[model samples]
Target: MTWSIVARDPETGAIGIAVASRFFAVGARVPFIAPGTGAVATQALINPLYGPRGLALLRGGAGAAEVVHALVADDSGRDHRQVQVMDARGRFAAHTGTDCVDWCGAIADDLCGLAGNMLAGPQVLEETARAFRENAALPFPRRLLVAMAAGEAAGGDKRGKQSAGLVIHGTEDWPDLDIRVDDHPEPIAELARLERVSRERWVHFKRYLATGADPVGITDRARIDSEIAAAVAAAQAQDAGEPAAGKAPAA
Candidate 1:
């Protein structure tokens, strides 16, 4: 019923998950990530517990393989669950339950794991992983979107698309970006639009928020507002292929 990619950005140590499913609100249950720990996607029959428990194990120094092994070890329904994990160290592991619907399986490689159940075919996961690997130059979040989009193009969830989501975490425990199209005819496109919307303001605004290193973030409202305005205008200018004011190239 779903397919997903769990990955860690080797350059920034950011970890995240991107997922889509025929099911409603797949975002609410499928993808889970801890900032400095790892990421998990649990689908197929969908064991919600695997998300938090897997992250906890990752945080406790369990490798991706150990985490998956532990999670499935005691579950009587393991044969019906599909889960994948990528640890902070770029280790990867996955499980595609034997009882999952046909066209189900998983692939794990350093820094990435891809898994799906009830998919159109093996190409879905294959293209997803391939895209992620080939687009290493893209920003982590955008790379995820591109990869998922490739999977969709290769034939996504066999039943059709409904919900899609992307989640990313930076140095902070909180997510740098978490957007979902809980139910949409074109959930991936909707998710992409939301990503653009986020770039319009939220992305720059987040810089002023409190962080672990600086509990009390920027307090000067006027300065913060000015910075945000400048950031937005600069982004707009870049989108238009023009240099921002005071940033023009020298003749």
Candidate 2:
């Protein structure tokens, strides 16, 4: 019903997952990440437990392959499950249940995994991996978006499109770069646009935090607004066409 990719940016030590599907709110159900541990994508009869369990295994010092092994080995329904995982150290692993609907498969490599069930064809996973690899020069969010676009182009979930989401954790704050198109006509594209905007917002926050430069008194609400506006504009200007490229910053 869905496909997703979970990865860790080695340069910045940032962990994130991007997912899209014909299923509504696929992001809410599929992608999971622990700030300093790893990322997980659980689909195909969607065992919500995989999200927490995978994180726990990684937190306990298990590598991606080991964590996935533990999850599949413990579940009697292994043949009906699909999961992808990337540990903090950048090890990657994935599985597709044999019982999954037709055209199901997954690919894992270099701290990244792409998995899908009931896809239009096996090409979905292949295209996704290709997009990710080809976009190595892009920022994390752009790379994620490109992979998602590739999947969609290669005949996405046989069920069609509905919702999309992106999550990056282990940042300095909660809700760190989390964006979702809960139910939209063009969710993947919308998610990409939201991610771009989120990048601008992060820049504003960084400027505020690093410079202690506020437009007004600490107590003035209006001054706070202006300072934020200015910072956002600056960030946008810097990002637009300047070739934004860097791993997500460490938590």
lDDT per prediction? 0.86, 0.78
In candidate 2 the C-alpha lDDT for residue 248 amounts to 22
| Candidate 2 residue lDDT tens string, 195-249 | 7777655634543342224443255557767888887777677567643221221
List, residue by residue over 1-251, the lDDT tens digit for candidate 1: 99999888888888889999899999888988988888889999988899899989998999988999999998999999999888878888889889999799998777578999999999999888888887786668777887888888889999999999999999997789999999999998788778878888899988989999999889898998899999999877665742211111221
Q: Which stretches of candidate 2 lie over 4 Å from their true place?
A: 172-175, 200-203, 206-230, 242-251
For each candidate in turn, the TM-score is 0.92, 0.83
| Global local distance difference test of model 1 | 0.86
Evaluated at residue 56, the lDDT of candidate 2 is 89
